[model samples]
Target: MTEFIPRPDQPASTSRMPSPLVTMIVAGAVLSLCMGLRQSLGLFLQPMRAELGVSASAFGFALALQNLTWGLAQPVIGMFGDRYGPRPVLVVCGFLYSAGLLLMALGGPTIGLNIGAGVLSGVGIAGCGFGLVLGAVSRSVPPEKRVQAVGAVSAVGSLATLVIAPVCQAIIENDGWQAAALSFAAVAATIGVIALFIGGKPAPAKDHSAVASNTRQAVGEAIRHPGFVAMTLAFFACGFQLQFITVHLPTYLGICGVSTEIGAIALGVIGIANAVGSYVTGRLGTRYRPKQLLALIYLLRTVAITAFVWFPVSAFSTLAFAAIMGLLWLGVVPLVSGTVARIFGLQHFNTLFGIVFLSHQIGGFAGAWLGGVSYDLTGSYMTAWVSMALVGLGAFVLQWSMDDRDRPAPGIKDSLLGTS
Candidate 1:
């Protein structure tokens, strides 16, 4: 009898899956730090504008630039992560992130702020944010747990928003915005070190099907697929709606005669809700069509926004909206990431997902920049908010139309639990 052995590229990933707990924890921690830093940038706009005498639009443009740059760089960085592993990419980008924060501190409102916070930080986010971390964690697990892995990491990262938003607000309130930025920078510097422990060991292959496919062919197929196009379009709306709210909510609150502190807390609330919702999202994806779940998520978002915008502004309504919107917040991640992974396989997950994320950041750019421009023009965020609600409907429609059939993965179940 001849013994069959797998090659290095297809080594027993399923059997060798390092501790899923470790992957979740470490990747989650990295996401916590990176997301905490990235999402908290909005809290600075008021102080920075007041100190530097720049219009709301100008500050928004800087943030918009950051989104655009992050989107543009993610594919390249993701390719690096796919080829060389995530650790090296994360290690280098961690330094860049720290430097970007420090530059924001040193430069304040100058053009350097755009370069530091927008350009450099955006690039760093591409390397260290969910684009890389989710994939890394997913890679550490067996095929069965891949969706759960991404969801778990996303939930963990969402927890950071719950904790970090208040911290950013508190820091900005007392120690000042620069202090918060500097503190986050210091935290980001530790990500590379932390990445060492996360999802480094892949599980042994559980089956013969865990093969490495050609990255180019995968990319080409995905690009040509209508489902992938729909996925990207929906994700772009996700970016636009999320960034518009994250970056402008503080100012939006002020326009509504509400306190900015409330906005901060709202962000935190959204994070907490998302943390919970994302976990369920992963589980639900296993049992239901991912496209249906995505459509539902966007529909919920649409409902939440429409209700919030139509009602009178009050603390209770705002908080209620936050809680609802938060649930809708990150539920999209696992679905998007898992869908792509399922469609194309994990061999080129980082790059393929990164392309999807690039579409997202383009939406983020418009979302963040437009809120400011709209506010400056009309003295309110009504336009931006309303536009977001409409976009949510479009996303809902697009997601519903996508092909949700699971491709063949030797041991994996092809049909969702509820589907034929």
Candidate 2:
């Protein structure tokens, strides 16, 4: 029943900051580089298995570990961004991301894959990923424009897969997976330079702002809010469905007798649709309740999954499925982040989003790891796919029934009403 109300003293927008367009562009670049490499890892799985003799489960576990690491590190990294600034966090994460890819390329099966892909890249992504970037964008824009700005950044960020996936696949086919990874690492290294233009530091919250006095209170309030709880739990399904497909879809297509090239093309199609979807979702958020839109996305995802699994596999179906999934992909981001901003304000935006994102990563861990485990155990991905669809359905129900009313921060005077 409780939700956060905006502080009256809070500025409608930040002053002396870079133009909103510049900020969103820089944020998109950071996300694109970070997410592009992370999302495209599936392309390396089969080749790695073939060359290094690693089992599917091992690779899955590594990716699961990666997601776990990213989740575990996100809150801490987000806090750092909130207190100091996002710039330093992005720079350091870029280096780590580049190093992780290099190690994955050169380290071979056991050590390289585990440390590079799992721990290092995971940590890298935690800082440079959506939470920090979206928080920065939200802080710079007006309350009314926040969701749209977040959507634009997300849409641009999704475009990375359009170019990265196909290029990586090409490199893998011609040279080797290692070569493709090395190329990814090189691209990742650019993130640090991009960070220079992001922003200097988090703007200080005004004295009369309705925000929590400290990080502890902000996190505590978020945990106690029922809507936040539902959102976090529902995010688990998002992670599960997405991670499973990203890590296993290529392999799944292969089992159905589809060529690897088709899988690559399919991911590219998802990227294209994801951009359009993210932008449209952002625009829709302005006119609709985000919770309802979120529920719809989950429902549609479930339908798409059911159809994909129930029908025959072919190039057309695969591409069409990818497009549907892509349209649904990353759309949750703007909604979830926008909801958080609406409910809590921007004082600790990244930290709060990061906590919620932890649930998503946990689901990602299960989805990625379980998909591989199921395949190894039953020799098919049917169980994992079914499980993902079930989770999405559950998410739809929970999201639909969630309470999204604004709960004012306790002890703050009623006079202190809008966002800081």
Best by lDDT: 2
Per-residue C-alpha lDDT of model 1 across residues 1-420, encoded as one tens digit per residue: 122121212213534334668767888898877887788788888888877786888878888998999999998998787766777788888889888888888776765578888898888888888877887776666566666778878888888787778888899889887788788788878987888765443432233223434566557767777888899999988999989878887787777888888988888888888888888888777767788888988888888888888988877888898898888888899989877776666667788899999999999999989999999999888899889988989999999988655444332232323233
Candidate 1 wrong stretches, greater than 4 Å = 1-17, 199-214, 406-420
Best by TM-score: 2
Please provide, for model 2 over 68-167, each residue's C-alpha lDDT reduced to its tens digit, 9 standing for 90 to 100.
9999999999999888788889999999989998999899788788999999999999988998899889888777777888999999998989899999
lDDT of each: 0.79, 0.88
Q: How many residue pairs clash in each candidate?
A: 12, 10
Q: Candidate 2: lDDT of 117?
A: 93
Q: Once superposed on the true structure, which residue ranges of model 2 sit more than 4 Å away at CA?
A: 1-16, 206-210, 412-420
Give per-model TM-scores: 0.90, 0.95
Model 1 alpha-carbon miss at residue 163, Å: 2.3
- Give the TM-score (vs. native) of candidate 1: 0.90
